[model samples]
Target: MPLSFYGLLEASLLMLNGIAVLNRERFLKKVFSFSSLSHIKFQLIFTRFFSVPLIAINILVILFKLLVG
Candidate 1:
C-alpha cells in the first residue's frame, strides 16, 4: 500500500536473493557436480551489481523520511 512498505519488501527480497546467489555453490553441488566456480562467481557479482543500488536507495528513502517528515 505505502511506498515505504514496498521499499522494505523490495530490499528484503534483494537481500534474500543476494544470500541465495552467494550460497548457490552449496545448493547446486548436489545437482551439478561439474558446475564451474567461475559461473557461481559471476552470479554473485551480477547480483551485487543490482542489489547495492536498490539497498542504497531504500536506505536513502528511510533517512529522507526521518529527516524531512
Candidate 2:
C-alpha cells in the first residue's frame, strides 16, 4: 500500500465528494433534519474549514509521493 494511502484517500474523497453533497441545500437539510438552526450553521462553517485545505494538501502529498519514488 502507498504511504499514508488512507490519508490520501480520505482527503480526496472529501475534497471531491463531500463538497458537492454538502453544497446542496436540499441534501444538507435532509441530513440535519430536526437539528437546531445553529447546528446547521456550524456545519456549513466547518465544511469550509475542513474541505478547502484538503485540496492543497492532498495535491502536495500526491506530488511528493510521486517525486520521492
Candidate 3:
C-alpha cells in the first residue's frame, strides 16, 4: 500500500477514537451532539489540514510514475 493510504487510515482511526472518547461524556453529547454537527465540523477541519498535502503528494506520485513508466 502507498504511504498516503496508511496515513489516511491512521488518521481516520485516530479521529474515530477521539470521537468515541469525547462522546463518552453525557454533557458533551447533550451540548455538542458529538455524533452530529460536530462531526461535520471535525471533518471540515481535517479536510482542510490534509487535502492539500494529500493532493500534492498524489500529483507527485503520478508525475513520478509517468516519468519512470
Q: Superposing all C-alpha atoms, what RMSD in Å does each candidate have to the true structure? A: 5.0, 4.1, 9.0
For model 1, residues 1-69, the per-residue Cα lDDT tens digits are: 467976687678667656655555566555545548766776667677877876676687678879977
Positional deviation of residue 33's Cα in model 2 after best superposition, in angstroms: 11
- For each candidate in turn, the TM-score is 0.35, 0.46, 0.46
lDDT of 2 at 46: 68
User: What is the C-alpha lDDT profile of model 2 across 1-69, one tens digit per residue?
Assistant: 556976677666666655555555666667666567786687768678866766676686678779986
Q: Residue 16 of model 2: what lDDT?
A: 62
Residue by residue across 12-65, what tens digits does model 3's lDDT show? Answer: 656654554453345454665556777778656866776676666657666876
Lowest-sum lDDT 10-residue window in model 2:
16-25
Q: Considering TM-score, where higher is better, how would the candidates rank from best to worst?
A: 2, 3, 1
Clashes of each: 0, 0, 0
Better of 1 and 3 by lDDT: 1
